[model samples]
Target: MSAPETIAVAMSGGVDSSAVAALLREQGHTLVGLTLQLWNQRRLAGHEGMPESVQGRCCSIDDVYDARRVAEHLGIPYYLVNQEERFENEVVKPFVSEYLAGRTPIPCTLCNNHLKFDALLITARQIGADRIATGHYARNHYDEARGRWILSRPADRSKDQTYFLFGLTQDQLAHTLFPLGEMTKPVVRQMAADAGLALAKKPDSQEICFIPGGDYSAFLAAYLEDVGEEQPDLSGELVSTAGEVLGKHAGIHTVTVGQRKGLGLTSPNPLYVLQIHPESHAVTVGSEAELMGTELYADRLNWISIAELTEPIRVEAKIRHRHEPAWATLSPAGEGLAHVVFDEPQRAITPGQSAIFFQGDEVVGGGWIVNRNS
Candidate 1:
């Protein structure tokens, strides 16, 4: 008889990951459930605008308790691995730095790339597990023909999480599993209920786990105060795209590209933020048409389907998580950079966000948006 494979399941105490544990255990796999304690919600609580209660956030103590309950129900060993310091350094600090630099950063992507997979994979191996599994809605398979592990969009397209998973390396892909990739959120919830797991109706975590109420600006203020560091000066002039100064703004940390509100100035036609200059601290505003662009440059590239991009390839590029893939031509610009020219203009191509390249459902590669030429 064959021995049951030892697998570490990253349980978030939510229905999705809990369902993953249930399914894997049913498959006769020896499970070691791990919940990474990424952040302490109570650390900065009671500070200005920060919530004391740790409800609705990921990796909360309440969540750890729920994960323990699920593991106890499954009759498996469960452990909480403290990664607060690493999470703050790799995910939280970078998020704050990018925001203060007048760029929009996706903390979820950083968390996945740095903590969840990288740190979790190391912990899984140390604990005698061969592979780690999670509930992310993304598909990965070993492509024998291409001799590379390929990541693809999951069956549940709406819940597809491959956009944030672009940083996963080939080795990481080989050692990871996504059991809930093919299942939809509704189906997973139903399965959790069928398995007699609590939290079957727990709502999906939408806000940044460490930041309560989805307020990055408030979180930044509170976080800076907590660390005993003064908030960097973000006050700058609101300028037009033609370098015409329109008005003086409070700070750059409060605004993002494509924002139309809180400009504090009246105009004949409604204006939108075109770009943010971190060095000069200038926020450019213009008409909605100015937001459209057909070309962008991406750096720090990671290729999944192919080993290296030697020549120009046709791909559908996605600038945002919800963005529909647009037909584009991708060419190598230089080392660790790619030039993407879209067939049609994309709107509000913000910097610091990911630009993922896709061919059909398979992920070709992706990189960080650096600059765009409208």
Candidate 2:
């Protein structure tokens, strides 16, 4: 028999990753469990509106303990790499900045693109591991005919995390592994039980690792105060689509597109946040119909199925994670930009969110949504 393949598993102390480590070890592979200490749960604790205890959230001390326990159960080496500084600079700062700019940002995508796939890959290599495996529900295969690594949606469409992973480059995909791509959540948990892993029944973490209670508004306030910075002067007038002043808003950072509640205005018709202008700090409120738009321009393009997008192509464009993919025509607008016109108008196509284009299950490319045609 030949030697086992050396693989490093990114253990999140969850059933999925624990099961992955056990399955690889069962295949006689040399396993090393690595858990990135992405954020300090106690950093913002005791701050106003911030949770004092962060036990159930992702990347907390409890999670690290669970990961270590799993590593010990498999008798594999485990290490917790402290990447708080890098994570803050790469993910947290950008999240706060994006929200302050009146845009809804996906920090998980930034964490995956900038930290997990990039920095973690480097760390895996440094430890003499051949490849890094994650618990993400996505798959990638090298297309010999196309000469590029093609990222595709996983078998479990319900657990598909491809939307946040659209920024993966060819090189990153080459070195990454998704063991849970084909396995359902239940099957993964059962596999962990078979492997004698204690976290087989552990609940999956649904909140962002850093933000306790999933309150971004409170987090923004506490985070900015912690950094000795004052919240931006976002006080402005709440205007209608026709430039009719409705009322005054506290700030642009306090609201998001498509939000219907907490507008502090009483009218016969319900008003929703249609737009937010960071420059003038004007919050636009209108009916839900005003939120729909057919065309959106995206910047910061990263192509996966092809080397570069040079012409118009038909694809399903997903504006946000939960939004359903809609048929659209994606064409090159200019340098580092793509124009997408959907067959149906999408609601709340906000900026700072990724626009992932898909051709069937395969991701063609994606970019940051910069603006929408009004």
Candidate 3:
């Protein structure tokens, strides 16, 4: 028999990733545990409303220690790779920019696309490992008929992470493995316990790794202060759907589409943010019914199951991580762009979020949502 493969596992110090390390070790593969130190939780602590102390988040010092302990327990070589500069440039900077442009951004997807898969893959290869495994609940395989790598949803739908992984290229899929794809969260926790991992019952990290308290406004202020940058004055008018000015706002960066609260408006009927215009810095508010839309445009496309999108195709599109896949007609609008029209009006097709296309369990491709007016 050939010798076992030397696989580098991305251990995030969570139950899922630690369980992955244990499983691979049990299977007799040479494992190198790698934890990317993407953020310093204390960098902006106690600044601009940020909490002085934070815990239970990814990339924190505690997570690195936990990951190191797991590697030691599994008797595998572990390395904490520092990629803070790259993370800041690729994920944090873009996150702040997107918000400043009057759009909401998903930093987790940015991290997965730029750091976890892309940067970590390069680091893995530099260390003599041919393949890297992650705790993402997504499955991928090579399709002999289509001659392309296929990424699909995992067995545990609730834990599915394919939405964030839509940007993974075929090359990345070929060199990566998702061992927890077929296992549920409960089963993974059990496996960690069986392997004598101390963090078997550790809670999953929910908020953005760099942001504490899940407060985007505060994080933006704190990040700007930390970097010695002034917050841009994006303050503008809040207009009604028919072009009537309702009121003035502090800044567009503080609001998002589909938000109903903190508008500082007191009307007999409730109002919601229908759209945000970055050029004019105008936030448009209207009734909740106005939030529904049938069409959206997405750019920065990445195709997986198929080589490229040439013709209009029927797909179940997911506009957000928590959104159920809705029936939509996806068509190539221009080079590296797609136009989607859902059969039913989906609520709040926000710019800067991803629109991931799917045919059943398989991820067809995905792109970043763009404002229709843009």
Candidate 4:
């Protein structure tokens, strides 16, 4: 209970976040834990009537209790901040729409941009926190000579999370801290065990926070209240890029880029959904070879490398978070639009998905893909 430098750490009741809270305390920093309560999308599935326990999910009711328990164990003030409105607008809504539009939505990236980093960082400033820390497996370094923040990977390459964090702004980076980034998962768990923490040996949650049963289509049908949210009755035919009708589809949302199964159509060769035309409500199916695309256009660009975009920059392009970085040349299209041509063709470069850019391991910038060569 001694006076210490105030630092707010986001505690998700997970192994990593719990380790972060414990480490900050060891550093003699006054820790205040903040956990954002996001809407649970899994409730739309079979567990609809069963009360959600935060024990397994980040947004679940049981998770709040677990987070609070960790905070109390660490003897730090903990709070659950309701971010349901923002989460709905920024993450869940877009998630359902992207699927409905026949694209894969990366909810982790949305949560990073909207809830975890932006909203919570702003809240930290309001509460006069010196820094806001998280359990992300990404390292940050201040380039003393250039006087800028740099993002890099943690010791664990498999668990590295720099890709999901490309949307983080420089301002957000300035006030952020990652205590466990310097150590691998094993090391982190060891730290937690040494501190007598409860989640020292807990397995990481693998499923998306919102998709409990991993059946995305079913969850969307129940959560999305849009007039057409329920399976869209597509009166159009499923055609190939060569104008060949392969089959018929109920809705475009039921399929996504890079998808190949459950098409309900018999074919001599395996079929894959290459693209979706929302206007025509047509889900385009083609051979796997046709799914490759080299060039793409993106808008709503966010640059994290420096102050301004003076000219077309060369960096690694990412079709989505978790994808390996690939070399690309990007040119701005006046406003926020960006033209990115990858050195090599990437698979399923679908529209309505993000294409983040990185310089080496550090994320430089990114945007929403408006077009793809596919």
**By summed lDDT, which 10 consecutive residues of candidate 2 come out lowest?**
1-10
lDDT of 1 by residue, 1-374 (tens): 13668999999998889999999998899999999999988988998888778887877788899999999999999999999999999999999998898888888888887778988889899999989999999999999999999999999999999999998999999999998788889999999999999789989877778888888888999999999999988899999988899998877888988899889979999999889988988999999999899999998899999999999999999999889999999999987889999999999999989899999999998988989789
Error of 1 at 295 (Å): 1.1
- Where model 4 places Cα greater than 4 Å from the true spot, the runs are 1-4, 40-55, 144-147, 225-235
Task: Give the distance in Å from residue 310's predicted Cα in candidate 4 to where it truly belongs.
Answer: 3.2
**Clash count of each predicted structure:** 0, 0, 0, 4
lDDT (0 to 1) per candidate: 0.91, 0.90, 0.91, 0.78
lDDT of 2 by residue, 74-98 (tens): 9999999989999999999999999
**Global lDDT for candidate 3?**
0.91
Q: For model 4, which pairs clash?
A: 53-62, 54-61, 54-62, 54-63
lDDT tens digits, residue span 228-258, model 3: 8999999999999899999998899988888
TM per candidate:
0.97, 0.98, 0.98, 0.90
The C-alpha stretches of model 2 lying farther than 4 A from their native spots are 1-3
lDDT over C-alpha atoms for residue 276 of model 2: 89
User: How much does each candidate deviate from the true structure in C-alpha RMSD?
Assistant: 1.5, 1.4, 1.5, 3.1
What is the C-alpha lDDT profile of model 4 across 230-302, one tens digit per residue?
4556446789888888778767776778889888888898888888887888778888888888898887777
